[model samples]
Target: LFGYVLILVLVTFDYKELAPLGYILYGIVILLLIYTGLFVHTIAGTQRWINLGFFHLQPSEPAKLAVVIVLASYYSNHDTEDGYRLRDIIRPAILTAVPFVLIMMQPDLGTALMLGILFVSMTLFVKLRWSTISILGTVAMGGAFIGWKFLLKDYQRRRIETFLNPEGDPMNHGYQIMQSKIAVGSGQVFGKGFLEGTQGHLHFLPERHTDFAFSVWAEEWGFVGSVFFLGCYFFLLLWGINIAMTARDKFGVLLAFGLVMLIFWQAVINLFMIMGFLPVVGIPLPLFSYGGSSLLTTLISIGILMNIRMRRYQIKT
Candidate 1:
């Protein structure tokens, strides 16, 4: 509900000119994402978010929902008794490709990777056959290799290279990851106490209130706070999974599952990235992060979950 409202407002304001065309929404989004990547939010040489005076919006955030809706709607109506046919996989392949390409074009390797994860999870949930999945997986891998060899922009390649050897560029490409580790280690169980974190206060951590926000919490609240935060995430995931299981229909079920995967995968990945357990792909920490776009999109997704839950018991007369 809130997500829809926010989308409405975004369309009403920033995208007003394109809203009436409807057909152009996707193009507009892609174009703006490209523009931001090339010019607006080129920090660390990856273009993901766009800074509007009032808010920093991530076009990829809504793109995730869009992909989920298209997939859920298709799977809900299709028959899969004989297992997923090539055509069934093709439909979703195309669905996942557009956003994946656009986001990758933004050079947001992390979010793009998340989209790939979403695709695989949703496809598996739809009961696509192992043989079919294997064939498709191989092709996808081949395509990714081709993209890496031919499609990836230079900086993106560099990010991968740096990930392979963080120590090779500790003061440059690896600084964020290295500093993040230091901050987490410095917390020492109970944390340095709120607002007293030297790393964050001294600005040693980049994007502290956004992508690295978990580090901020960990620094201030320490290991105990980290556990509590993880607990909240655990509760949320369980709650969403419960909703998925109890959904009244296949559409509701798939929709809930997609939402669950989106939230769960992203939360786990972001947390891990900040803890130096994973590469810095620049995924955000959801509600606790300071991005309006992410917060709005997350709340809206919850609204969709609520919508499914509320109507679960109300059969039509």
Candidate 2:
């Protein structure tokens, strides 16, 4: 498949080659985000994709990876043992904010939220002063208030409200979450057997293959299967983290860690959303979700992790 081919091509070259191009790619994605907002028509009520003929390329999907690379490259170059200070983080903050603002304008809260988490993840990896953490935490709360008030779309607000009280609007905004909970709970201990799930088979679950992909999966596979499914991701993430710890260079370390965090947050958010612990933010369940862009992004990120692992020792010669 194309995913296999992308990983193959990505590992054939040194991932360090990406260091110089991080900002370039980030800039291009930022432009694409702006272009999507200005010219692209809304598909499914979101201007987050481009008509790439064969595929509708979602800029926000790649935008997450872009932030990872940019932050990794920046941190690798400017690292200090004492940890990052207030002044040290300003540029990285701006780099993160640019795409955050642009994508938020498209009003894709999920992707925008991912970007913020990406920045925090990478920044924490390098370590942050308590002063910096407190400052950022306060700012984040303020920003959330602003986002809720003026930035979130009506439907997005409804999703949050529905998260708080699904029964309050069970037929309207609450339908997705309610159905998701049922599908997951009905799976019981072992599941309904593969492709035998009632919720998805009866067509009651919307976005069954996208945002709610895990719900359909859980319905079919049951609790045991769900744990087994998550176990796979657990190993994949741990492998990535091991690679980051073992990588020979600072760039390789940061790159591997940032990419792993990218996968981590997406998977966690999607899982929590489906289980009713978090509002539906439209985050795909990584490789499981039926999305060309999300799948490829996850694949390429894993490839980069492999690339770092493969050449972790070759840097000396």
lDDT of each: 0.78, 0.91
What TM-score against the true fold does each predicted structure earn? 0.85, 0.97
lDDT of 2 by residue, 238-304 (tens): 9999999999888889999999999999999999999899998989998899999899899999899
Candidate 1 has an lDDT of: 0.78
Candidate 1 residues 176-226, lDDT tens each? 888888888889799989799999999999899899998888888889988
Q: Which ten residues in a row have the lowest lDDT in candidate 1?
A: 11-20
Residue 8 miss distance in model 2 (angstroms): 0.7
Error of 1 at 134 (Å): 1.3
For candidate 1, give the lDDT of residue 106.
65
Q: Give the top-scoring candidate (lDDT).
A: 2
